[model samples]
Target: MITTNRPTGPVRAVEILLAGARMQVLLVRSHPLIPVVTVVQPVVFFLVVTARHPATADRADLLFAVLLTSLWGGTLWTAGGILRRDMADGTLGRNLVSASDPRLVVIGKCLGSCLLVLALLACTGGTIAVVTGIHVPLAALPWLVAGLVFVALSGTALGYLLSALFVLVRHPVQLTSALVFPVYILGGLLIPTSALPAPLAALARGISLYWAQRLLSSAVSGDGATLPALLVLGALTIAYFLVGNVFFVRVVHRARVKGTIDLG
Candidate 1:
């Protein structure tokens, strides 16, 4: 009976992440409808929203913000769903006791899910651009890409956190569905964060989504504080990842003691 809490080294970590990516590939191959569910639905939602309120320079920031929301929302669903599915399918118990850190299980899910989310975001943005002719200059593409990557990292960390949390619930998939819009609504995914009530706004700042939206929105608007925004985004990403790992560690410990890894 080995009871240990040692850090997972870089090599092992990468292996775990790659394993998660491979798992995702198998999932996509098995379920051809994943792309439709993750990508097309968001694009449709974007189209509907834009129709209701078109983008102009005054509110053009919403364009990328909404795209970020699509990826963010997708990450939440995919990560939580994957984790819950693994639990139900009996894989989580094996991984929890295997060589990998239990946290890596969540991290792996996030990495694979983020890849899909990126593709989904790109599809949504490209489709919107084709019809609306809203284009970012070539020079801006790098900045835009960086902003999107930052958002993805933050979102991935968020998904990892949710993966840890949703494991404790009966209907974990609904957990993500419940949070998808509400977090955005409060995080200023469509509107500015300042419009939120003071307490809500403060709470928003603590979450990675708020920082991600702020950074991406700044990049979209060409306000040119992207370096600082990137810094903040990185900080928030690290914070979320660390906090999520802590939560996962606690849950894993509890599950091991109670022998409920498969039960959840």
Candidate 2:
């Protein structure tokens, strides 16, 4: 039987988180499809977009859009089913019975995924730059850096929420795939929200990615106030975490009472 005597302290928590992050990074490295999804696919998309819209090839905003799309894809494939991976590997039960909060492990895994995606983003950026000779103004660098930071944070939060929610669904892979294009459209990652119908555009505003795209656009253009978009993105991220926490608590309780971590 698993014991609930695991050490409880800030140090212990940090250790667990670091361990989880390491494990996640290893898993991502081992997974063949993950690299393709996070890097190659985005590069291919960038190529196609530049080919079709040669006029926009030099625009930094185009690069930002591709990066945001890639980040969303990474969030779906890497962090979306994190708990399911733990359950399949027979660690979820142990984590549940441990005294330390399992959510910390999840958070660490998400952070690890974000780090991996960031590395992949750099590769994607390099490839795109080489292929298209697109150049970003030095003046926009600070804004771009800030936008990237928020993108990572928002993606991590969304991944955490999805990881918790996906555990409740019987077919998480199906759900994950189904989620891809809708968010692309709704988040305005590829197309401007202005092109979307008014009602759809209004609904898209509820998604953090919508605001994230707005921030990135401003970042690339070096125009418009980024504060409003940043504030909305931050608010939506916090909301996702709060709701996800509630779901995680309920799911963990149910798992404990039922004596099974395979809630799906």
Candidate 3:
């Protein structure tokens, strides 16, 4: 691990975040799977789905679903393993001792992952547009952009929370693989919550991606109240951050007590 002077206060936090972001960028460059999941998989899924439902090819709403699905997948596979990668690389203990707040590092990594995924989403969207001829109204472009930003934020928060939980698991790969489709179904990214049973529909309301999809749908359709979805999405993001911080604190405490950060 690289070493540097331990700065104090907010500057330290910012530095830690930048470091994590840089680390994430480096990881993405080295790891071929990040792009495969974030870009290739989504593009292929979009093409396959559209081909199966030829009538829905031009629908703007489907584009939003595909984009959100990509975001969730990228977050789950990339940002979700932040701490696990650190532990495996033998840097988690060093990071815990060196950083004032390790959560900031996770946040930074999530932010970096989201940014990269967003760029890949743009490429995916462009490719989908060229192939399917899907179009968004000029007026709706602003809302769509705002919706994308919120989607990234919501994904980042969820990634941070998941990372904290994943670090404690013995087999995080199985757990991570298990999470993908359930979140897709629950989040309404590819499925409509209205089509789900009453209990599942109600449960979908708790997932941040559900609100994100609602917000994106509203943005694409220019129907429904965007404010409510935006507010709920923001609230959920804050809640995830708070809950993730608590989880990180507990994980740190446990690691310290056990004299090792590698719980897995």
Candidate 4:
């Protein structure tokens, strides 16, 4: 008989992550409405808003591009909300009993959400390019991708923090929608941070969304590229993951204490 030792270390983490990701895929496939609300709404908004000012082609193009980029926040929020709902309903608890880390499960779902966002962005961006007749700077595409990934991670962390609260509170979806809009607008999707009032502008500059948008904007805009934008985004990405990890651990501890995490 042949015997093999159990996996350990980073290799085990990767195995757990992949397994958790497959589970996430199954969950997403079962929930069709999530894609409609989470993915389609952003695309619809980009098309409608940009169409209003068709004559200002360049302005509309830039606005549409930024809008597409901002969809990461909504995607992450929706994914985290769904995960929290599952956790509260005890499905996640059942998964926790398996040989998988809860943190890895979270990571897997976040990655799956990010992949969905990327697919949506590609589809929407392609459609916009065709419908609006604007040519994207092909050379800047790599940087744009990098910025999107960074923003998605930060936004996912923020969503985790919010989901932790929603698990406990179970507030109305409309209220959550109302709460999320400012984060988008103030994130420089609608108005540039430099154009906002001084205090709000300063506050916006400190946010992960702000830095993410700035990095993306500088990459594709006619304005000169700025190294500082990349630096800011990198810093914000690190900060968000750290904060999110702390918040998630605390929430998990609380859930355990309250007996909220149990297999039904």
Give TM-scores for every candidate, taking all chains together and pairing residue i with residue i: 0.83, 0.89, 0.89, 0.81
lDDT of 1 by residue, 190-260 (tens): 66678888877777666666666666666656787778778988998998788778778766876789766
Whole-model lDDT per candidate: 0.70, 0.79, 0.79, 0.63
lDDT of 4 by residue, 1-264 (tens): 998898898999988767755665566654665556445765676666666756664653364445544464445455557556675567766655566677777766665665565566657666766776666688878877777677666655665555554555545365566666676656666566777787777777767766766677677774665357778877877776676677667667665676654334
Comparison by TM-score, 3 against 4, better one: 3
Weakest 10 consecutive residues of candidate 4 by summed lDDT = 60-69
Count of backbone collisions in candidate 4:
0
Q: Report the error of model 3 at residue 207, Å.
A: 1.4
What lDDT does candidate 2 reach at residue 4?
88
Residue 23 Cα positional deviation in candidate 4, in Å, after optimal superposition:
2.3
Q: What is the lDDT of residue 142 in candidate 1?
A: 82
RMSD of 2: 3.8
- Superposed Cα RMSD, model 1: 4.7
Displacement of the residue 8 alpha carbon in candidate 1, Å: 11
Tens-digit lDDT track for model 3 on 1-264?
999786788887888788887778778755787778767888787777777778763456677778778788888888888888888888788767762677787799988887888777878787777776766678877877887788777777888888888887778999999998998887776778888988988888888887877787777677877779999999999999888888788779878787645743
The lDDT of model 2 is 0.79
